[model samples]
Target: MASSSTIQVKITAARKKTSLLRSLPLPLTLSFPPSPPPTVRDVKTAIQKAHPSFYTVRQKLSLPDTSKALPDDSAVLFDSAGDAELSVGDLGPQVQWRTVFLVEYAGPLLIHPLVYHLPKLFYGAEIEHSSLQKSVYAMVLLHFIKRELETLFVHRFSHSTMPLFNLFKNSAHYHLLSGVLLAYDVYRPAFSAPAVAGTWRANGTLLTAAWVVWVFAQLSNLSAHLTLRALRPAGTTTRAVPTGYGFSPPFALSTPNYFFELLAWAAVCALSGSPAAGLFFGVSAVQITLWAQKKHAAYKREFGDKYPRGRKVLVPGVF
Candidate 1:
């Protein structure tokens, strides 16, 4: 086996398909160690060292044969042979992935409460919200509050940044698509609008059960987040397979955070019965499922047979 420092790799530039940019330069060679391995960031660093303008954010690395881009985080990329090749695409103007996430969540974080509390401005009258409506607002606000705090403190992002245009698109989804729309639906002048499924307020038994379940689900989701955070330590891009409370039987989703988050949202949906809330829940489920699938595949590739076989993508035994 070649020493870690002696493993050689070819870095090829993946240019834009436009004819004007078709005339690309030749590939560059880099030596990496198999022991430590080369992460997507490491390859980007080498490219930047050789070509100053191709910084990390603007660069996308993938296996030579595949166009699917590698995530630029603690992701350790692929196993390398002495002659393995990586294709690096120039993604153009970029911003930190963290920036985009924070900005996106920030919009709804502020907007949800603003519209809920100030009825005169949005509803155009000094209207009082029903007890049920108030409870819905509390749940939604707390959820995003947890998310905002987690993004700032608990969560560790894999990718450093993304295309600049993504900021605008992502913010709109939170601000308008999910945020403003849901706020309007829940806090509208007609207080009855929120009950899309059924009115939990009318049934004390249902209300108690929903709130209790919602609390547990939120805590479970948080436990999953902390477990995931513990996998990657400080000042390094190291990663490992995750395990803990939420990862065990009965709650054994490959990505437990999303599963728990969905569960929490389900409680909210049940209590409010708002179509907008249900729609948001549906969108979140679909998106989280896709993310969970990717993470599951990544865990398989990174750990080989070491990754647990029992773990399903988003659901425990079903999915």
Candidate 2:
């Protein structure tokens, strides 16, 4: 009688396991020892084990009925037992997740400017002669080339792959903007002509001063990035307050890199002598300032009193 009762209990447990598996959404199934509640990380590991293609770092596990992503992968899955059903979605429609390096992003941004500029320089006779246009071209090329090299050797990414779709998005953004800036500032007759059209002259001292600022800002920005990269070692996610060349307080405004970036773009505006370039700088400045504020808040939250309280968000003493 005891043996018979034990066999029936085993059968019931098997049926319960089968039912739980059936209730789970497609392509996701959890198996655990049942003594301890499984964690979101555990589930992610199981999914990766089963799928082999879904890497834990890249995987964005979410509930089936909502778009809100799980915040903490280490949280207990059973804590939200009622909404325990999970689903896996690709980074984009019809596009499976694919890994891309920072260098890949940098390479295209560097090359695209040259690809657009060289033809214009060779074929467009007016642009070929315009020193102003040539100077603008040189600055743009230098900026992107420096970016590419920095991405390759200096910048350390916390996450390895951005969503594959971002490659298309970012490439289009940089390439299209480059085209517009080049078209308006470098190729256009009204903007590129000397002493006749724009307020600033092609070979004027103001343009020379702008070029100086651009070079200084570029070097300063490179130094800032190197300082940031050094805060954490390779393959670690440690965050530390950045210090060095351009970062001494009260000059240590929030995101000194962004401040330097603004300076560089402002130089481009001066070099181009176009209102369009100024507009571009304005838009970029707003965006970078917003990002800087966010970074500042995050630093405060993470480091508490350890983060410098005197640092401004973007501009020192003003913003």
The runs of at least 3 residues in candidate 1 whose Cα sits more than 4 Å from the true structure, single-residue gaps closed, are 1-13, 17-51, 61-87, 192-200
Candidate 1, which ten residues in sequence have the lowest lDDT sum? Answer: 17-26
Model 1 TM-score, all chains together: 0.79
Each candidate's TM vs. the true structure?
Answer: 0.79, 0.73
Pairs clashing within candidate 2: 254-312
Q: Against the unseen true structure, what C-alpha lDDT does each candidate score?
A: 0.76, 0.62
Q: Supply the TM-score for candidate 2.
A: 0.73
Best by lDDT: 1
Off by over 4 Å in 2: 1-23, 26-41, 62-128, 191-199
